[model samples]
Target: MRVAIVTVGDELLAGDTVNTNAAWLGERLTERGVGVERVVTLPDRVGDIARVVNEYRAEYDAVLVTGGLGPTHDDLTMDGVAAAFGREVVESEEALEWLAEAGGYTADDLAEGTADIPRGARMLKNPEGVAPGCVIGSVYVLPGVPAEMKAMFETVAEEFSGEVEHVASVVADEPESALIDRIDELRDRFDVTVGSYPGDSVRVKIQGGEAEAEAAAAWLRERVDLKETGE
Candidate 1:
């Protein structure tokens, strides 16, 4: 499975808030065998978020959108999704009840449209906060707050699970330049991606199915004195 992650927040762009959501999602997605093709960080602009979400949904199998679901004015991720799909924003009864139960605030006490989402969107419960997330089409709209987003994501993470990727790595004392041709050969022969990183030692990462990665590893070991990095 291929996915794109969109993190929305002015604070993240300004460096006031660290953009840990993208990295966390990327790692988790990779662990589930889903390749993250792109990660985008956008300000709380509805049109821009909508455009990206629309584009990514068509380009990738899934689009994981984080941030901008709040009671504040800057919270516009939901609006963006609505715009992208041309769906109307309506109060979500399920979300209203969740908000009331989670925050101990009545629907009337909360800000107007606080529990609203695009029509026909599936409301995703937020175990950690009052504002729940929503899934409008392929785009999963999540909260900007890390704690809430993490909690909300767990409720829907299984939907993204896919085949497990087999990854193996090796480290050689030689520089990456010395292995450029070898890496290309491995890619062609094993049909696996080979990444060469230069440092005090060169680290080559081989990724594909289990058998392919193992074959690539064996090929490298025979050609160069390489130490196994890990599984």
Candidate 2:
């Protein structure tokens, strides 16, 4: 399955906060064998979130949106997501009960929009915070806070799964330029994707079906003096 990730925050654009949510989600999703097709960061603008969510939903199998899910004024992700599907944002009684029970705060004591969510969306419990995330259609809305997002994702992690590719990595003593021809030959001979990272030493990564990846790794090992193996 291919998924798109959308992160909403003005702080991210201003370099006040790092966009680690996207990277973490990408790694987790990739580990589950799901291909992350796109990672987009946007300001906490309803229009931009709506447009991107609308567009990505049609293009990808699923869209995972994070950030702008707090009770603050800049938290406009839900509004934009609601607009994407022509849905209304309404106060959810179930969510209110969750917030009250989990956070020990009554409805009156909470923020104005604490329990507001897109109508018809399934609320996702946030184990790490009071503001719950939700799922609308093919889009899974998640909190921006790294801790809350990671905890919430575990609740629905089983929903995303695909064919897992085998991965093998090796560190070679040769320079990157000197390995291009061999890398190309390996790709031509095996049904695997190869990546070469240049540093003090070249690190080559091979990914594909188990047999193909193993074969490709072995092929590379025979030609290049590998310093490290199996990453």
Model 2, clash count?
Answer: 0
In candidate 2, the residue pairs with backbone N, CA or C atoms under 3 Å apart (3 or more residues apart, or in different chains) clash, namely none
Worst 10 residues of 1 by lDDT: 221-230
Q: What's each prediction's TM-score?
A: 0.90, 0.96
**Tens-digit lDDT string for candidate 2 (28-101):** 99999999989989998999999999999999999999999868999999999999999989988889889888
Q: List the residue pairs that clash in candidate 1.
A: 67-144
Best by lDDT: 2
Q: What is the C-alpha RMSD of each candidate to the true structure, in Å?
A: 2.5, 1.9
12-103 per-residue lDDT for model 1 (tens digits): 99999899999999988988888899999999998999899999999999999999887788988888999999988889998887777777
